[model samples]
Target: MLSIFLTIPLTMHSQSLFEYQWKNRLIVIFTETSNSREFQKQMQILNQNQNQAGLNDRKIKVIHVIPDKHQIVFPEKSGWQNSNLYQKKESKIDFEVILIGLDGGVKLRETNPVEIEKLFDLIDSMPMRKAEMRRNDN
Candidate 1:
């Protein structure tokens, strides 16, 4: 596994998805608008499990993207834009949750709100996470 402290910050803009690519595992919430019920439910699950056993110690970051609103909300702040990060050809019209790994790859994608336990299990099963655990034990 790559050393956590060695990751680089990619960039800053109306959307900063790449900024977290190598530094933290990202749970990106993409919605048509911030008012979606599914988005709310997913956010609630993340909030509830953020500090729980399987997730707390891991470097996880959350990014909320609302294409209709042209906004991106990070944990500490949010940004608004006239244009969206999702282009017309690549955008998903429905609500979606995307889990990006520290290696800058999409690890998981779901159309429905996910349970925290399930998310944790998926994350814990990753090879990088397994190596992290081994390193910590030593």
Candidate 2:
């Protein structure tokens, strides 16, 4: 009788699991709310689609910025209600999606994820994305 011991490599798999490669790409931040399960499910689906589309190198980071008491101010105070992106949209009590460029500057700020495709288009049109595509084409 022969006994064999097999060791599973956990580090590599774990790294890939939590490692999103969007450090220099577009940042998609979502405010966490009581109805966060839906957003989480949507994000999971989006990640799956991205992987299937061969966009592994173009990772999208989904950040959940939980608002504190002081941070929870009325939207009307900051002209948020009048913004084009927020005018007619109705969101849950606490929810937001902020799109930021690679330089850490906010590009498109919205109160819903319905316009996420626009953010993708904006990122794809960025100079970095163009350069990366050119490099890959070589």
Candidate 3:
């Protein structure tokens, strides 16, 4: 069952789960157990490419926060990952990856070992993403 879920691919699952309403600017991320250093490095690369693309820099903004359960949330897995960052009282957050939209909506969520190109494609294809960019330039 786990393998089935894993095989579904983050983008496809997220799109369906989000109902394609995810299009046109939002946050997308691939999180994993923090102990996975390779995942972190991959995330770094994704961010770098995104930065160069000027995607988040223009209209939309993408962010990745590493949640520290002990420091941020006492119980840790108690919905902290799903909780709205603003709603949480803790000053710190722990997440393998987080994608938030300009409107503060979550686009997609997943664990690491993802296809980075798919993420980039998703960003490029957002209908509103480009519009937001144009609006920002003005």
Candidate 4:
């Protein structure tokens, strides 16, 4: 399994979003508005399983973006921004969730809330995750 804790950069920038999450899986959540019900549901599921997802060891980083409102919420803080970066990655739908692998590529996208188990299972199946697991076994 992937390691439990990894060092993230001290700074965050829209231009280098993926660069900061270079070796970590990213869970990007986009909503039409900050108060959207779907967004709340997604947050709840993720928050509840924060420690349980990703091979029982990996801790996913979550980025909540309300593009319509030009706001972004990080796990440790929140701020206002143009939303161009997130908007470009979002689907046409108003509410969407994207899972990006450690390789900095989007692995999954959903228009509705996704169960934690489903997300964990997907991560556990990744080749990189398998390699991490094997390495940990020894």
Q: What is the C-alpha lDDT of each candidate?
A: 0.64, 0.42, 0.39, 0.64
Rank candidates by lDDT, best first.
4, 1, 2, 3
In model 2, residue pairs whose N, Cα or C atoms come closer than 3 Å (at least 3 residues apart or on different chains), thus clashing, are: none
TM-score each candidate.
0.73, 0.51, 0.41, 0.74
Give the lowest summed-lDDT range of ten residues in model 1: 4-13
Candidate 4 per-residue C-alpha lDDT over 1-138 given as tens digits, one digit per residue, 9 for 90 to 100: 222122222113344454645566777777777788998888777666454444236546677776533433434445665546444643578888877777666678789999988888898889988888899899
lDDT (Cα, tens digit) per residue for candidate 3, span 2-77: 2212332432233222332334243433233434475556546545654545543433333322332211111112
Q: How many residue pairs clash in each candidate?
A: 0, 0, 11, 1
Better model by lDDT: candidate 3 vs candidate 4: 4
Clash pairs, model 1 backbone: none
TM-score of 4: 0.74
How displaced is residue 106 in candidate 1, in Å?
Answer: 0.9
Q: Relative to the unseen true structure, what is the Cα RMSD of model 3?
A: 10.8
Candidate 3: worst-modelled 10 consecutive residues by lDDT = 69-78
Taking every candidate in turn, the Cα RMSD to the unseen true structure, in Å, is: 5.7, 17.4, 10.8, 6.8
lDDT of 1 by residue, 1-138 (tens): 333222212222334555765578877777777788998888677776444444546777776766534544434445665545444213345777767787776667788998987777888899989888899999
